[model samples]
Target: MDKFLKMTGFATSIISWYNINKRDLPWRQNASPYHVWISEIILQQTQVKQGLDYYNRFISLFPDVVSLANASQQDVLLAWQGLGYYSRARNLHAAAHQIVERYNGVMPDTYAELINLSGIGPYTAAAIASIAFGEPHAVVDGNVFRLLARCFSVELPIDTGEGKRFFTNLANELLDSTNPGDFNQAMMELGALVCTPANPDCAICPLRTMCNSYRLGNPFSFPVKSRKTTKRDRYFYYFVHESDKQLAITRREKGDIWQGLWELLLIESDKRLSENQIVRQLSESLNMAPLAVSHVVEMRHLLTHQNIFASLHKVKMPEKFNLVTFKDKIVVYTGRENLTDYPLPKLIEKLLAQYFDLPPKVL
Candidate 1:
C-alpha cells in the first residue's frame, strides 16, 4: 500500500508537470480523431520537430479522413515523400480506404478496432484510442520504455521479449486510470523532455525523488538494449534519360526501396557493375540502345539497416520514344514545370538538384 501511494504520487506529479510544460503542438488542439491519428503516425519513426511540418502539410492536403481516402496513391506518397519508410505511407493509404469503405469514413472508437486497421500497431492504436477517444490504454513507445526503465532501474534488455512484457505490464499497472489520456501524454512528454537517452536532466525531473536510477546515480544504466541490427550493403545504378523537354521516371512497383513512389530508372545489385555491364543491363531493361552512357556522379546513402552505394549515369536514348510505350509501367514528366509535383526519393531529389543547379531540400 505504501509503494502504491508513491506510484500514485509519481503519476500525479507527472500530470502537473506536463500540464505546465508540454509544447503547444497542433494535434493537441482538438479531439479530432483524424488529427490525432495523423500526428501519431507521422511521429512513429520521425522526430516531433521534423514531423510538425509534414503533419501540417498532410492535414492541409488531406484535411479529413474522406479527403485522404479519396486521394490517389501517388498524391499520398507525394505528401509523405522524403519522410522515408515508404511502407508507412502505403499502409496509411490502405487503412484510410479501409476506414472509408468499412465504417463510412468514421474512425473506430475502440482500441480493438483501431489495432485491426492497417499501419496501426499496439503503440499507435493505444495513442489514438487514449488521446482521441479517452480510452485507458497505456502507450509504450521508445520514450516510455526509456522513462519507465530508468524510474524503476530495470536492467532487462529492452529489445528482448521478456523485457518488453515486463515494461508493458508495468506501464499498464502504473498508468493513471482516471485521466488516462493526460497521464499517457505526461509520461511520454517527460521522457521526451527530461528523461532523454543521454544526459537526462535529473535535477529538474519531477520523478527525481522516487526514481530508482536517479538515487543510484546511474540513470543511463537502465533500459539496457544490447542487440544491434546488421546492415547490408546494396549498389544502385540509376540512369537519367531525357527526351526533349520531357524526362522519364518509373514507379517502384516491386517491394523495394521507394516503393509506390516515382524515381529514375534503376538497377539494383549486390556488386557494383562496370560501365559496359551497366550499358548492357540498361539496354536490356529499356529494350533499346543508348546513344551514350556517361558516369555523372556517385553517392553513399545510409538507411536504418542498409548502406546504399549508388552511381548515377546519363543515358541518351537513340530517339524520343512514345510516352505511351512506358505508360503502363512508368511515368513521363512533361517538363520542369511539373517535375516537383510528383514525389521523389531523397537520393533522386539530390540528383535533380545537381541537374538543375538548385539547392537540395530534405525532409
Candidate 2:
C-alpha cells in the first residue's frame, strides 16, 4: 500500500507537464460530452494525427446526438469514410439513435448509464465519465499500462487476465479522486510524450527518478505481454469495372470484414489465385462472360492478424452486364467526384486510387 501511494504521486508531476505542454487538440478545447465521445471512438486503435480530421468533421456535421440520430446511416457512414473500422461508425450511429429515442437525445452523464449504450465498453465509459462529467473513474489503457509497469517494476504479463485485474485495481487506487479526469489524462500524456515505447525520454520524464524500471536501466522491459495472434496470409483479387463516368462497387454485408461499407468486386482465396482463377471468379461474381482483362497488378494490405495480397484486375464488362441494375451489393460511383460522398472501406479506396485516374492527394 505504501508503494502504491508512492507510485501514484507521479500523477502530480504528470499533471504539471500536461498543463504546460499538452497539445492544443480540438477535443481538449471544449469538454463537451458529444465531442469527447466522438473523439474517443475515433482514437481507438488509431493515431491522433489520423483521427484528428475525422473528429472535427464528425462534430461539425453531427454537432449533437439529435442530429446524428436524425441523419441517415448512409450520411453517417459517408462522414466516416476513410476512417477504418467500419463497425465503430456503425455502432456509434446505433448508439446515437438509441440515445435520441430512449434518453430524449441527451447523452448520459454517468459511467454506468453510458456503458449501456451499444458501442461503449468500460474504458470508453470511464473516459467519458471522468473527462466529460468529472465522475471519478480511472482510465487504464495501453499508455497507462506502460507508465504503471515501469514506475512500479511490475512483471505480470499485461496480456494476461491476472495482469489486467491487478493493474485495474492498482489504477483505481492511484487515481486522484479530486481530479480523476486530469490525473488519468496526465498519466496517458506522460506515457505518450516521455515514456514512449521505444527510446523513452527519461531526462524530461517526471517519474524517471522514482521509476523502478528506469533505475533498473530497462524501462522498456516492463509491461511484458503474451503474444496470441497468428498472422495468416490471404489473397484478394478486386475487379475494377468502369464504363462512362460510373464505376461499379458493392456493399459488404454484416458478418464479413469491412462490413456495412462499399467495396469493389472482391475474390478471396486461401492460396494466391492464378491468373486464370482470377478471371473465372470475376466472371462468376459479375455474372458476365470473362471480358478482356486489360490490366492485372498486385498489391499487399496488412491487417493486425492477417496479411492480404491483393490483385487488381481492370476489366471492361459486356454491354449487357454493364447496364445491369445494381442491387445492395452492386452500385456505380459517378467518377471520383462523388466518391467522397459514399462510405468505402480502405481496401476499396486503395484499389480505386490505383485503377482510377485519381487526382493528386485525393485521399
Leading candidate by lDDT:
1
* 1-363: candidate 1 lDDT, tens digit per residue: 237445668778999999999999999997588999999899888999999999999999999889999999989998998899988888888999999999999999999999999999998898888898889899999999999888887888889999988888888888887888898899889999899998799999999999888899988787898788999999989877778868778777766778877777788889878888888887877777778899888899999999999888888766655444442475565576676788888888888777666776621
Residue 161, candidate 1: C-alpha displacement in angstroms: 2.1
After superposing candidate 2, which stretches have Cα over 4 Å from the reference?
6-8, 323-336, 359-363
Cα miss at 336, model 2 (Å)?
Answer: 4.2
Error of 1 at 297 (Å): 1.7
TM-score between model 2 and native: 0.93
How close to the true structure is residue 154 of candidate 2, measured as C-alpha lDDT? 84
The lDDT of each candidate is 0.85, 0.81
Q: In candidate 2, which residue pairs get closer than 3 Å at backbone N, Cα or C atoms, i.e. clash?
A: none
TM-score of each: 0.93, 0.93
| lDDT per residue as tens, model 2, 213-332 | 878899879789887779999887777777775777767788967777777767789997777877777667666666587556677888887898887888776664563443326565
Candidate 2 Cα lDDT to native: 0.81
